[model samples]
Target: MPVSPKIYHGNSTPSPDAELAALIDAHPKPSSLSEYSYGTAGFRYEASLLPCVFVRMGIFAALRSASLGGEEVGAMITASHNAEPDNGMKLADSHGGMLDAAWEEHAVSLANAPDSQHALALIHTLLSQHTSTGDGGNSSKKKLPKMVVHIGRDTRSHSLPLAALVIRASRAMGATVIDHGEVTTPQLHHFVMHANGHMLPSIIPQRCNESGYCEIMAMSYAALLRTGSVGGKGNVGKQRLHSTSTLVIDGACGIGALKINQFQHIFEKLRAEGCTVGLPTLHTVNFPGDGPLNDKCGAEYVQKQQLPPRLYTPSSKGAVSKRYMTSFDGDADRIVFHFEDEAGKFHLLDGDKIAVLVSSFIQDELRCIDPEGKAVKCGVVQTAYANGSSTLYLKNVVKTNVVIAKTGVKFVHAAAHHHFDVGVYFEANGHGTVLFGPKFYDFISAADAKLRGTSRHNRANIALRRLRVLPALVNQSVGDAMSDMMLVDAILFLRGWDLSTWSKLYSDMPSKQAKVKVADRSIITTNENETAAVAPAALQIALQAAMDDMISQESSGNGPKPRCFVRPSGTEDAVRVYAEANTQKGADTLAYEAMMLIYKLCGGVGAPPQPLITNRL
Candidate 1:
């Protein structure tokens, strides 16, 4: 008989306390125990199997603490927004970012070492030598080492247990652990800096007088406030501002609700001071009674929801009720927002919107601050899946340099570190990360110092200046919904512009993506050659010929040629089809037509079936 599945709430599956105790005692041996193989995010593993991974991670944390002047290390084990089947682990640095590539390579090597005994010995030696002498290899100052590691998880069923495993391991390693419980990825990152003995600056704006000049002054004051200072502080003198922001948060019924609640609290406090805060009213549909809220109801499933009433018209007057709706996956790391027009139509604001908002805000505000200033030129780094419109807008409209990297957060993180000041990369499925340049940090610090020196009356003016610059500072160096929300809010609020107006600023080209799940996981792509396995080279040539024929039939040869990238899905047993064109109809037509041609090449199996075509922005 097929066993019924169990369910749990508040970031974990329902494992009976007795069952959990039994499972802990059984110690179901993992396929293998390895060292912390930290990646872009950190050490990740299947949650059910994470206890084993945590054992390895504990040793690694001890090693990292010893080597880095006795600083504590941490682990993150939620899959961000991946499906339930997938889970991962990541090792966070003392600074809250993931370990650098060199360190990650070292960790991976340790994990893949031939002998576990040898790996443990190496870890032990590293820890002993570093911790014993307070010498981080070359440092001579006896650093009053205060190492704090903040750990949290999103709403994945495995998150709680996985987080518990991490907490247990960190404590076992003798590191003081602050269990943030369920929090957004960005909030976790923010806590890292905020809790690390750093006093962030806050902005306080004076009430807007009838002269509209007060509003301008208030806006400027808000702008001047340092990004990190606003939320951590208890109060910002009363101008009584309600967020005036209405967000339809598709919480995915995951741990995102925790983060969303934090945002609500922030807005609520602002509302108490007098700001109009609106929340995305949730209306559940197609939810299963027995199953946990882990399905497509949140951001991933938002494309399928009924268009909210506020988005119906583009030109409807009286504040058109600008609404920003976002959904996070099973874990709250990934985010995708929806903007409604006056016509009650929904539009997706994916990584492209992120790029657009970040780029436009930086360009407009920085120019206002100093027209001829040669501050570091901000750039947007994205994956190939970025919408054609985004690339064009960043280049022509925003005039920011853009770099296209491969998919995955690691690649984005690496590119952000290497190339740009503000790297914005998001997968078509809505995973994203942002990188902020060091110079941006310095600028905000200087502005904050100026504010600190001013008197109370001038404090509001200082706050205004900081507010103008807050968008650049508060945003996380990683892709996070909370950070993205704050970024979007800062941009639109400062400009008093609505989302539809901003989205219309640039025309987006049409793009379509298709997923094909294969029955056999062994049918993997080797060396990027899609036709390597087919017996006859002629068959490969034939497939290419078909794609070429389609491309040749294009009507307008003006823009870039039709682009398609076929690859195996990273997280699923399937193949993915991505096609982009100048027009949506054209993109869809070409995609479907190409699928047919490819299907014919594959012995007419019809390219492995898939679920409905999810219209992800």
Candidate 2:
């Protein structure tokens, strides 16, 4: 057996043990809640269990920071897409990106520590394991690195106390801590990315909010400056919005709602500061402080159900299908945009759609930016969750390179970095962003500077300007619904198109997702790409037969364009099945077939899977 290294702060002040002890004691006689395994997000469970997790995470954050030469590690205290009572915490790397995959086990280890004392000991072990004294051996003299941690949270009522626990725990460890109160997940990420470089965030309250808006807005405004309706030159007399141009926002009554309100205030301030383009008039709904968050209204609900949230019922008045509408998840990390048709049909533009459209636009810009045909190639990365038609369209139609990765942002982000001028990644759930490699940004900067003296009147010049500003406008730190909304808006406005026009880009096959309780989800392993299963070897064989059957059933050009796959969920104790077909009936039949087969093989906790059919939107 190996020996444990000495435990002490390397170069910081002494630990605040009294505070740590009191905090550990104050959280209440720790209820012996069910065990929790760190999932795609870090530690998540009911808010009650999160205090203990937060305690361990505080130390984990400090260790992470110290290991990175005292760089500030980011911690966010919001459970995105989960119900209101659920809360989770995840660490950001030194520069405001997702937590490194290699280091995740250490966190999960710390989370699994049986009690405070065990977690405390694990912290020291983590420090020793990660510390390098610029020497070759792990012999002796290793010590804790200096630590700095930054914390932020959403508007969850339960999150505040959890946030406080993180604060106290970090303080107890003698790490430098900064509390940026009540920010969306993206805002926290942006702050981390900005603070890591010369892009320091404003320390002031109102100014911080205003400055944050300006950073993304500055880029967006420049891009849209040529539009007269946006206060530029052409169509100068056109109102900011007509009937369809007006936006109705469903915030999911979460942090996104509050930020939308805050952004509206910042827009006014920006207008006062000589910004020309007007912020679109927004009708905010489902804002936080109004009701339970993510209860029944959010991107998750809209996308999965293929319908608008209950609160978002179409009015009898305006053009129901024409107006643009969007929804954000509980913590504002995911978004799905939709609109109803004149015939009261609903259309969803999910992450797959966003990836295709956004990447295509960027690809077009790259061609024009280097019009000499030097070929600044861009590409897309997606998960198995991406629609099959989307993957095909991207590979064949868009002509951009396409790569598939596992089901998390870190994996996709890494894959996108390997070979592309720009990489766009998104889950079907609407969590994703466009990444511009350093060389790409440098190329854009050079192109913009080269065109500095040219007239901005030409549409080509305007497009180039938008490309230049896009690097800044994109929240490359993470997938931000707000930033993405702005990007989609800019693209639609630039193209002079509406949802109807965008919908015409490609039609989504009718798809369905189902969840089945499983006795041992762990046994349901996935293939490397997570597109198919690895265990119960016969499962794959069965799925193929089901596809063949579905295809045979629809052989005459009306059959299901059958696609089906099943995998165990990382966060929940269930297996998820996905199916898509050219027709609603086909999709339903495919989903039902897949579900029934999985339940038969995988110890499902219900009556045999029943056929679930809904009118496809």
Candidate 3:
């Protein structure tokens, strides 16, 4: 077990009133407030001001919960892999997902509410309604029990104090609270669903209208049904005869361990029910003090050649030699799969492979159920970061439409919701999600209906309930490790295919991504004049000219055309450089050469002193 860090406070503990006073005193007059804004990632600010930003976030959490019938709320305060100074807040509903856009707008309205008192009053009213006791009078009709709010933070230094402020605010509002210290966002979601003593009964006389409850109920049913069906049909007996399947989980020090444990426990129960369960056997890397692995250790770091021994060893004669391996990043919201081939070689199942496998599975399964066998009308969406091979595979091989969007899970998620029956999106970084169309949801729900009023449905639904547990999914959604694991498991289980086999479908182009910390985050931007304003105009011109020259030379087709995207880091005061080409050597050459040019134009190879420049590039 890892030793937890001690919570320390400065000489003085600041009260909300005192904290507000101090903030006002330090900042004095209010700036226009236009500088602070919210996006799909949520409200972000420098770590120095996170204390104040959290106060605002708390208010938003309360308001959103209130508007949604006073359900419980949660907030995440750590920037995933961003530099120390960058921090952000994600406000989650009771289900652990982002609040709907309308709710976000409402939160913004409350945040910008004309006066402080008005803002505070609006928050107070919502908190009161969510937690209100049915004490006499007409209020009884509308009053509800105090909502329970769970708060979790990441590894950043500022997360603890910021979390403290959030906890204090919830307690102040009379809402019951759970502070899951140092948990990954996905672990928090798992805690929200399966953990005991985590849920509080609603005080409202009317039945609670939580959006996630039905989803949870359905998941529980799905898990039970699937397990029972396998056990009842003697699938486990056949599995026992053949030997239990083995799976290796590499939790990249993220919160996904909890979900994997849940799967293990659930599988154990199935094994006891005469199902042949094999190994869960989790190998955790990147725990505290182990040093940061970042992209190098998790899915991004896994190359085709790195196969763990457990996945390679054969069990016995006449037994299937298939073994599975998966790894998750910091929060366990995304995942990548690995497997060993017959020749003892390892292979990676990148997002493209996952998309191909999932798209095919959905299409095939739906066709089996639908007599017409008409196309499912589903499309696959990806970002510029997607491998060129993936695009060709989807169109020519799978014969499905592919839509490429800008980088970011937000855009991908939105595309999934709006356009297709089954929309798949992934960042080459390994973040992905499968948006089940209403028809698919109904199909699954209907399949579940056949086993209604039985333990089978109840057990199976536990697994299925995960789909409805969106608050945690949404809250931890951005590049989450846990959610990704659960998602991959669900899809693989449904498809009944080895994830490793899917990676062999196509070869990927070599790619590389690097980051350079600039003196000022504001100095780097896609905006032309605004970016020039922060850095020297001459330097900007030189950098642009150099990039253009590189693009032109690379486009000549003597070698793989090198492509690069240079922009300011959203989560840090740095410039990010991403380059891809036909070969690893070409990709590295382009990145290195670009960095050299930028550094030369700026005056030196190393970062400037006072400006505090650092380059992972």
Candidate 4:
């Protein structure tokens, strides 16, 4: 039985210490299981094992907010591409990014406490650290600032109950919790960042609500469309705006679909008032209840299989005449675009393509704004998983500096923030965002002020206006499918380019990704960039020999040579092998061979993995 809060600290309000003890007693970790460690995202497991974890995390979120002097922190309940039975939670720091690395260890300690006594002790120790200390005085007497936690959830059936646990635990710790129910992951991030004063209301133009997200997106998009391109680049008139077929979005049958529908309604409302230009019609498929989330659709499916979603199969009746389509993951934080060529073959424009295109456009804009390259510096951050062709094009063709970061969005986000004036980062899996440094924003503001003297039709004036509104068009705190789609559309309209034109900019070398189940995935490790395996010397040696053999076999190919790497997956119980080659067959063979090698070398779980069957002509 759970202890009532009123029973502790006397009267109605319980003391923090007493309340914490009661909460810990109410939710205890299983002694039979090993300690849960926070991973690349956060705590994830079967929904059945998470109720206790949520309570502890909720209390920790409150502690984090108090530690930050009452700055708003966020707790989002989502699995993000995982099956419905599996759910997870990730905490956002005051800046609205992933939890700070320094505190991840503390999170582990709190979640792994053996019993209620140990848990209470850990909480007390953490609480003492956050209190003021002076002249050997007792720190426990000092009162901490009021803590605030912003909570959001996805459409998972278990998500609401889990969110309720978080809210209850947070309030028990004497923190105020604001519940934003059924929001996309990025929307919650946007709310926290906006509430904490990181983004200017004048620039973003949103009030931190569902409607606010749409308002800011619509406003920025309209601003960009109204400003004609400089030089001979075409302006976005009515015809150019709708030149392409209706954009069909595969929503992965999750919360993103609902959010897209809401955005569409908002767009239509704004269109009627003439506050926005008419753009291509957005038709969303696989909405909630259309099917189980991410069964055979979503960005992950399209990017890995290199096929259209199940609903948009080549022979399916739902296939549109449009040359382009896009898909959003469960929570709408990631997006990827795909299209069919004249031969009815599918082509995916994964995150690598998005990074190249966006960076290239920004590069051109910066050069146009200042040919001397003095105002801003542009750089792109990619993971080892990035297609080699994309890296080559970015370096040789885009004429920009490219840096490699370890896998995961946090690392890339950090690298982009530290490396350049305008940092563009994206994973090949379609999770990405653009970050504009303070210096870049300052430059744009100064340019806009200087161009005030010229007519709005001046090329420089138009370019400056577009630059000024670009940041608002992006969800700077995180990757947002809605924001990213708008940015891509605006750029395409400005450059007078279409899907085929974008695809022709650069070609992707064929690549394959496969995973092998292992008894213990942690036994495998890799270098900082994750391009090569480091641990289990025998495994590394075997992988190297395999990669060497494949490269030697493809040395005389027409395109890029073969490259391969095997790394342990952060979110699963398997080691993932990725191989790239000049031809699709070579890539597939290398991937299959490597997977089998890992399974044989390491402890094999079930049957050995099998290669996927492709029916493409």
Candidate 5:
């Protein structure tokens, strides 16, 4: 076994052991809660076991801010789409993204410390590494500003108490705290990014506050509508968009309900002044007190079940056939759209669908503005979970570069940012956003200057105008459900398409997903992008056999090939298996085959997984 490397402070002041120890002692970890890991959503667990984790994460955020020379960091208290009793936190870096990967290891170390003194030791080690002592090149010797941390939470009954613990621990580290009470996760991300100087004043031109978020989103949306509306000045504006004036939002009975209400009010105020045309009338359901958060409603439920939320049955007022409907996860960071057919069937328009729609629109607009598709690089980033049909559509139909990343949104975002000038990324579960790189900003600004000097009714000028305001409507720091909803709506409106029309852009292969419990989840691993199993030596071989057998048994016809993969979940103690094929029956059989293989080969713990379907495919 290798020994740990020695830690050095490099002449910094001694650690604040007394304060750290006191803080740690005050928030004691439960005896039964022995191990903790910083999973995709941070240190999540039953609310009762999270107090200690919250306090430690609070201190971690404070130190993280200090490491960035006093730039503000954020800690958002939410377990997006999890049940109400479960809660967690996600740290935002100064630039308004997830915490850096290097620091995630340190967070795990801090959370799993055995005692207060042990926690102090870990804190001291991290503090030394993070806290800078000397100026790099400046001779002026200006002092570093006080450390600051921004905090926000969802509507869970215990979220406020958890927030208090964070505030307490952060204060103990001499960090200033900005408590943004009762806000959506994306709103908090917006606040932290703006507070830390991500203000694109030329593009957004608004104050750095909650109202500023509303103003920027509203103004940009109105600009898109006014530029792309039907019967307007340009040839492009004559499309029959806005078939309906109403949009029903399922807010998951969480903070998104409150924020959507606020956004609707602001949007209507602008519409009344004739600033926008064909903006929808908002109808919000699953508001707080109307139901328990995420209890059979939300993006996760809708996307996974491929059905309407329990509270949003066909008879519900918002369930009008063919009308557009969307669902927000508990904290509103992820969103998925669906509609009830005239025959009362539920259909989901998931992230893959959204990615295709958005990327196609951007590519179309860029073609009009640049004629040659060379000025801007556009691409879509997805995960192994993306439907094979979507990957084909993206590469063949949309004709843009498509790549896969690991399952987390951060990994997908990083891949998108690295690959394209105009990168659009989304998880199959609907957590994602459009990232505009420096090249995109430069191209659009130059195009705007050129177009404004020419005819305003021209197609190039119209597309340029819409592209100019597009960035303002997105939350650049992270995925914001509200922002993405606006993006989908704008694309649908400009194209004059309903959910049915949009869904017709491409067909999805029938797919199935299942989770298998094992004695040790760590024993099951996968290659990068999680497309194939690598560990448990026999796992991949067995899965491949299943896939080959599946293919040979099917009729050779003009259909997509069957595909499947198994990977350990980053956030749970189980392994997830996903499969898709041209037919729903084929998908169910392949998925069930793979599930049984893992259950037997990977030390399955609980009862074996059930049959995926009752009838033969």
Candidate 6:
């Protein structure tokens, strides 16, 4: 017999006591007592340990909304690439990104409260601190701020109860909860950003089958086809491309699989509008049915393991050996590209390769938009974990300004926005997107208008036109798998290169990554860009000494340069160490020694150090 959880659910309206109270009463803190901290990706763990956290997050979410004067905020229920039983929640701001850094501490305090009553008291305190009735602090005359929270969740079993708890807690505080039911992580971001009038005041279609996301993506594809160069061929304008490109997708049997199914009809709509670009045929694998979510599949699995998702069989990989394939994480936010060569060896074109391709495609056009490089500068933003080779190419070959940011998406996104007209940011983990700043749009639009007025069939005119549309193709709010896939397909079509050509742009230096179970991972704070350690500065000295020792031992002077760094894993209870060298053996040795050093100096638990994952591709 099959059974379902009997958690209480509510819509926009708040419900009465019994059911909501019962659910809260049943969920207590974890028996093992893991300290809860709101880190990079929010609090994630086994589902059983997350219910109370969800309940408190809902209250803090309401307070966060109040802080913004009741502008609608978003709560996304997803662990994103974690195991089946693992579930998590992320609070999105009114601006379509993660919770404001300002509110993070308040959220952590609320989540760590002793009980629901204590959590409630904390929420009230937050309200009193930030809430005002136009008259300074008079408690008797103070009125609660009206808040609205837009909530969405991915398709996880634990998500159902957790979502219900969110609704209960939020509505109990008199906040309106617009339940978005099931959606990808990025889709929720799109919806909130759209609903909050951040981008445009358009209504997102209500029915799942009629979602306008496919249409928006199709527009991006159409924009590229109308003006982009393909294999040196001039744009045919409304004429269809003679050849069809195909992409094989690993859906990870999760939310991404369901979303991709809605896109086939989008091409027809574009054709009706007289832009006849051939739509890429999407062959989806691991589309959810009986399989568990993210079970040996998805971007995280492939990236972390340095292998294809277990569900991807050779036959389904690609009929031709030279085809391109990609995978999306559980909620479809991050993506990784993989291809099999003639000899059947797998090659990965991760975030690093993707950055190189994109920066190259736009650099010349961006330079022309502001020739003096005075107001509109184009650049690439990378994390410390980004491959050294990619950084070098962007800085030297592409001749674009390169900036390094902290390890998280929030940090990278900010750097991209403030400094560059065209900001291409990506973590080596395959989480990334391009940011077209305010000046980028103005410059590209002006350049296109001038070019259009001058020449009807010149290459500069076509290039300028395509450059203008590239920004729309990107979902600037956050990293999106669908948006990124379309952008990649467009780049491939423009370059007229198969996966093999794309892979040859630059080879990645061999690198290895491992995790050590530290007694307190938080103690491992980092320097400015997370490239060095802040506390016990000796850690940096040890890391640099190890790299120097390895380089000195290399017999060949032309070997790959040695580099290493260690940082605490924001999402886990372990510290992660990254090392790279010319050869795979050198990389392995460097990572091993680095992990051991951190384990010995810092308080490592259990055995010496355990290797979490390594990728030498």
Best-matching candidate per lDDT: 5
Candidate 6 structure quality by residue, lDDT tens digits, 1-617: 11121222322323323333444566666667656788676778788888888887876777788778888788899988887788888878887788778788888887777765565456556766787734342222455466888777888877978898888887765677778778888877776666676454222222121165566666766777655433234333332232326677888888888778667566755657765654567777777663677788888887767787766434554453235688899988899999777677888888888888888878765554455667577788999888888887887788889999988888988899887878898788778888876676667667766776665356666667677666556766788888898888777766566678888877888888778888888778888898888876778888889988988876545434778889888876688888888777888889998888888888888888654344443
Report the C-alpha lDDT of model 1 over 164-202, residue by residue, as the tens digit: 665554444445566666555654554453343222323
lDDT of 4 by residue, 1-617 (tens): 11111111111253555766677777777655576868888898888878778888888887788778789889999998888898999888878788889888888888888766777677667776764423222224455567888898989999999998888888777678888888889988887887788445355554566677677877788777666433444464544634353788888888888887766776677778875553667778878787888878998877777778866333342545547689998888889998887888887899999999999988887776788877798899999999999998999899888999999888999999999999999899899989988889788878877777887766666777788888888888888888898888878877767788898897898888888999999888899999887887787788777778878877745455688888998866799989888778888888888888888887769998897544552
- Candidate 4 residues lying further than 4 Å off, grouped into runs, are 1-12, 30-32, 133-142, 198-202, 229-237, 241-245, 275-278, 312-322, 556-559, 608-617
For candidate 5, the lDDT comes to 0.81
lDDT (Cα, tens digit) per residue for candidate 2, span 1-617: 11111122322334443455556555533558656577776777778777777876776787788788778777899988888788998678866688887888888877666665666556656656676633331213343456777788888888888887787677666677777777778777776676566433222112123255444654454345345343233333233445345667788888887777655665566667766453565566777766678877889888888778756433532332236888889878888888887787888889999998899888776665575535465889988778878887887888878888988877887888776768898888888888777677667667777778877655456556667667667776788888888787766666556777887887777788888888888879889888788897888889989888887776636322678889998877689988887778888888888888778888888678888868755
lDDT digits (tens) for residues 445-560 of candidate 5: 78877777777667788888888888889888889999999888877777667888887777888899888988788998789889999998798998898888888877536556
Poorest lDDT segment (10 consecutive residues) of candidate 3: 201-210
Model 5 residue 596 lDDT score: 92
Candidate 1's TM-score reads 0.70
Error of 1 at 72 (Å): 3.9
TM-score of 2: 0.88
In angstroms, the error of model 6 at 430 is 1.0
lDDT of 6 at 183: 82
RMSD of candidate 1 to true structure, Å:
10.4
lDDT of 3 by residue, 1-617 (tens): 22232222212232333443343233221353444556656776667655555665664564455444556666776665444466777666665445666666656655555445555555555445544433321122344343556677776667888887766655443345666676666445444433222342121011121223223422432342244233332122122111113556665543444334554454455557764322233333344334442334555455322333121212331233335667665455556777666666766776767777767645544544453644345788887667667777778877878887655666777776677866766666667766655555555566457446656334344333333332222222234554455445544543344555456677776666666655565644454312122354554565555546656655535333446555555655566666566666666665665465445443332453222222221
If both were scored by lDDT, which would come out higher, candidate 1 or candidate 6? 6
Misplaced by over 4 Å in model 6 are 1-26, 133-143, 198-210, 229-244, 268-275, 312-322, 368-375, 555-560, 609-617
